[model samples]
Target: MKNYLILAAGLAFAAPAATAQSTASATGAAAAPISAGQRKAAEELLAATDSEKNLSATIDRMLSAQLEQNPGMKAVEPEMRAYLTKYMSWPSMKEDMVQLYAREFTEKELRELTKFYQTPTGRKTITKMPELMAAGMEIGQKRMQEHLPELQQAIAEKLKSQPPGAVK
Candidate 1:
């Protein structure tokens, strides 16, 4: 259950980034030409975002909070520790996500995107995205809670309809 919640949280956070990447791709075809200075500015903004650092911090915080919420998780601490060790050791996950973005946009397209993001308007959007995502997740959680009872009841009824001693 905790794992599922963590996965949900991750997806929720990633959605905005995914949207940004898609938008970059979609607008790539006819984007306004960017100057060299603009490209450099965008690169600086990207560096400042420090995606890997942010992701690592978020993961650490989430895992710590999960362990606190579920003391039984202590029994699986070794597994969790091993998983985090492996995950953190792989520098490729962030690269892979970036590569996906790269694949979606040409080099010129990426430069233009970087240029736009470096601007005040773009910077503001980037800064507010995390908070926007958190709000989205809150809304999602409320909707899930609203439907949970009905979902549980449906599952219970379906299970009850099954034959006794049947392999699930």
Candidate 2:
């Protein structure tokens, strides 16, 4: 679960930069301070969506999930916790997450989202998001496994086409 959440979070954070494509523009955007209202609204949205609670749940499950999957890891649980704490602790990342959302959304939008998240349907969506994400990931993995031979063949063809001494 930790690995899954980390991958999900990594993709979430990376998606914006990947689309931005230029470091200078990305840096400029990062440097532009968010307005107070925007920050407040973003924080409110996070709270309404139970972002911190969700993160805590993920972290809580992580250790048990790891141990279940790899009993050998029990011997190194302390080391694993130290590493996860250093990099994945919510306290270290909450402000950055708030800023990320604030940057991506207008104050008005954030407020509207907060309002929606407070609704029953919105709450349901929040509750179901992890399950939905897991299902989608499973679907993707199945598709990838089904098509892996094609991918291997494509890679082989590409390698064959490359000059003997040159790497593609």
Q: How close to the true structure is residue 127 of candidate 2, measured as C-alpha lDDT?
A: 95
lDDT of each structure? 0.61, 0.72
What is the clash count of model 1?
Answer: 0
Q: Candidate 2 versus the native: TM-score?
A: 0.79
Model 2 agreement with the true structure over 1-168: per-residue lDDT tens digits? 465455445434322222433443456754469999999998899889888777666655656765787686588777766765666566766787777787778999999999998999999998998678668867989999999999999999999999997883
User: Any runs in candidate 2 off by more than 4 Å, and if so which?
Assistant: 1-29, 62-66
Writing each residue's lDDT as its tens digit, candidate 1 over 1-168 gives 667357445533453266665565567755455455544444444454555655565556656767787877778767775666565422635543554444455566667667777788877876776667668878999999999999999988988988987637
Candidate 1 TM-score over all chains jointly: 0.58
Model 1, stretches more than 4 Å misplaced? 1-48, 71-82, 88-90, 153-168
Backbone clash numbers for all candidates listed: 0, 0
Worst 10 contiguous positions by lDDT, candidate 1? 7-16
